[model samples]
Target chain A: MLSLFATDFIENSLMKFIQTSGLMAIFSEGGYKYVIMICISLLLLYLAIKHKFEPLLLLPIAFGMLLTNLPGANMFHAELFAGGHVHWDIFVGKAGLIDYLYLGVKLGIYPCLIFVGVGAMTDFGPLIANPKSFLLGAAAQLGIFLTFIGAIALGFTPAEAASIGIIGGADGPTSIFLTSKLAPDLLGPIAIAAYSYMALVPVIQPPIMRALTTKKERMIKMSQLRQVSKTEKIIFPLVITIIISLLLPDAAPLIGCLMLGNLMKECGVVDRLSKTVQNELMNIVVIFLGISVGATATAASFLNPRTLGILALGIIAFGCGTAGGVLLAKFMNLFLKDGKKINPLIGSAGVSAVPMAARVSQTVGQKDNPSNFLLMHAMGPNVAGVVGSAVAAGILLCMLG
Target chain B: MTLFVIDYPLPWSNILLIALFGIAIVFVVLVVLVYIMRLFGYVFTRKHKVTNTKAPLAISEEEVVAIVTALRLYNSALHDKESDMLTINRITRMYSPWNSKIHGLTQMPEHHNK
Candidate 1:
């Protein structure tokens, strides 16, 4: 009798342990999907580590995806944020590590903070020197609107379409800000697409740039820009923040934060604050933002036809954006006089990848004419692309939010 | 700020309208910025020009040159004459256990016989 009781106790304990193990959950019904999601995450990890494709964000994002997909770990709960509204009643009981971090994204705080860092690091001297670059910046947004129509035609809702179209902006934080507001469901795919394409700016932009412009147009050397004064530099961020915020109040958070950062940098009064924002604050927010955004890519959300469609449409949007900038620049040359004729090559930099896009313009131009240096000229449109995309995001929010 | 809210899918016409109007607004806003920046540039440049005109140098070019040359000569005269030589001096110091090679090396096992 004693031996039987001991045997029974041991058997029950073993059964309970086996039943509760995460490994067992993986082998249960409907478990293959989790395996697939995990595999995808691992693939992204490989890409991030080996290729260095936006590694800072992608690595954390990939790890978050891995954590959330571990069947029984329960690090993230999508139902808590179901239907694009946080279920605060159950949030405290059901929330996990990622849910807490995701609030920064849902509350529209992380992206704006990231923008402040970007602003501090940016030098607006180029854009201020050549205001016409604003036109090219506006022109690059053609991809965004065009993709909006395409996504709608392909059967996404207007809000979802807007979120997907923002990938063309080539501004990652702006993409996240718009998507988190307009369609939180699609945030994972849209962010991955935006960053991946941004990393590929050098690869993707050059072919389109080469195809669009003739050798002569590529070789066209722009005259040097006038020296921008310290006063103009200080006044620029203030004026831009006020004008853009007042015009489209929807853009206030992003534009205001960005301008504040630029002010901190240009004013030279708060060097420590500028350094902290540019380095420490930016790094912390990026880690949190990346992980939370990546955690959203569950099997149900990511392993679908829509993800495939977003990836396809995203590249199309990027291509169209590149073509738009180049074409607009060529068109502008028709009106611009001889010395003032703009190089169509610099137009491709209007996609807002910042110094990367500008560098591509320089590289392609140098290939055609060794003497040509389009980096500074390209920077004008590149920075303008940042403002242009913010305006586009604001417009989309007003129309479709 | 939302113009309209649609629970149902939007029609093709509305989609097109949003696209067209969105692009148009972006252009209009940026164009306004272009004009404003241009005006700002004009104002600042005009201020610089006025400052330049108002601040004509009191000293003539010849006088300035003469002053600079005399200052250069006086500065040269302040230095005492020395032999034109370049030398790297070596200084010796007493050894300390902190930096001595014997202290840095591991001690070898001592041979013992019983």
Candidate 2:
């Protein structure tokens, strides 16, 4: 009788352990999809670590993907944020670590915060020096609107299409801000696509830039930008904030935060605050934003034809954006006289990848005319692209949200 | 809140219209910003030019040059003439217990063989 009781206890304990193991869950129904997602995450990690492809954000994103897809780990719960609404009542009881962190993304806080950091680090002097760069910046947004049409034609709903199209903005925070608002389900893919394409800016933009402009256009050397005054710099943020907010109320959060950071940096009185936003706050928010956004890429959401479609449309958006900037520059040259003629190559920098796209313009121009320097000139459109993208995002939110 | 209450998979016409409107709005806002910035530049540049033109010259160029030259000559006169020679000087110090090398060194003791 004693032996039998001991044997029964042992048998029940073993069964429970086997039933609860994550390995068992992996072997269960529809388990291969998780395997594939894990593999994809690993590949991203390899790319980030080995090739240094936007590793600051990509590393955390890949780790989050790995964590969330682990069977039975329960680090993230999709049901909590299903139907594009947060189930606040059950959130506390059922939410995991990532689900809690994800609120930053869901409530549209992280991206705006990141914008504050980007603003603090940015020098609006370039954009201010050459206000005409605003035109090139506006031209690049052609990608966002054009991609919207393409995504919709591919059968995505308007909201989904809008989120997907934002990848062309080439601004990750803006893409996340817009995506999290419009199509929360597609956040993972859109963010991955946006950042990935931004990392590949040098690779993707050059071919299109080469095709659009002639050798003469590439060799055109722009005159130096005017020296912007301190007083003008101080007034810029205030005027832009008021004007943009009044014009597109939806854009207030992003543009407001951005201008506030810039003001802190330019005003010369808040060095501590500016430094904090640019470094510490930026790093903390980036970690939370990356992980939560990555957690959204469950096997179900990521392993689909839609993901493939997003990747395809994302490249198209970038191509159109680059072409738009280059083409508009060429068109503007028709009005500009000899000394003032714009270099079409610099127009491609209007896609807002910051210094990277601008550097590409400089490099390609240098190859054509080794004496030419386009970095500073290209920066005008580069910074303008940031504002242009923010405005475009606001419009999308107004029309589609 | 969204301004439009459109159905999913919007009609082709509406999609095209939205695209056009969106791009137009972006361009309009940026163009407006460009003009405002240009205005700011114009006003500031004009103010700078006015400030320059309004300020009277304190002295003529020749007079300014003459003053600078005189100041330079006076400053040069203030410095004493130096002999163009570099020399090494040697000094000897009185010996003290603190300065003695023998006192500073620790000497090893010799052991007599048994």
User: What TM-scores does chain A show, candidate by candidate in order?
Assistant: 0.98, 0.98
Q: Could you give the interface RMSD of each candidate, to one decimal? A: 5.8, 5.9
Query: Across residues A83-162, which tens digit of lDDT does each residue of candidate 1 receive?
Result: 88899999999999999999999989999999999999999998999999999999999999999999888878999999
lDDT of 2 at A51: 94
**A99-176 in candidate 2: lDDT tens per residue?**
999999999999999999999988889888889999999999999999999888887888888888888889999999
Residue A361's lDDT in candidate 1: 95
The reply for model 2, stretches above 4 Å from the true place, is A1-3, B1-8, B78-114
**Residue pairs clashing, model 2:** none
Candidate 1, residues B25-70, lDDT tens digits: the string is 9999999999999999899889989988765476677887899999
lDDT of each: 0.92, 0.92
Identify the CAPRI category of the predicted complex in candidate 1. acceptable
Models 1 onward score TM values of 0.92, 0.91
- Evaluated at residue A102, the lDDT of candidate 1 is 95
Two-chain DockQ for each candidate model: 0.35, 0.33
Candidate number achieving the greatest DockQ relative to the actual structure: 1
Residue A91's lDDT within candidate 1 is: 98
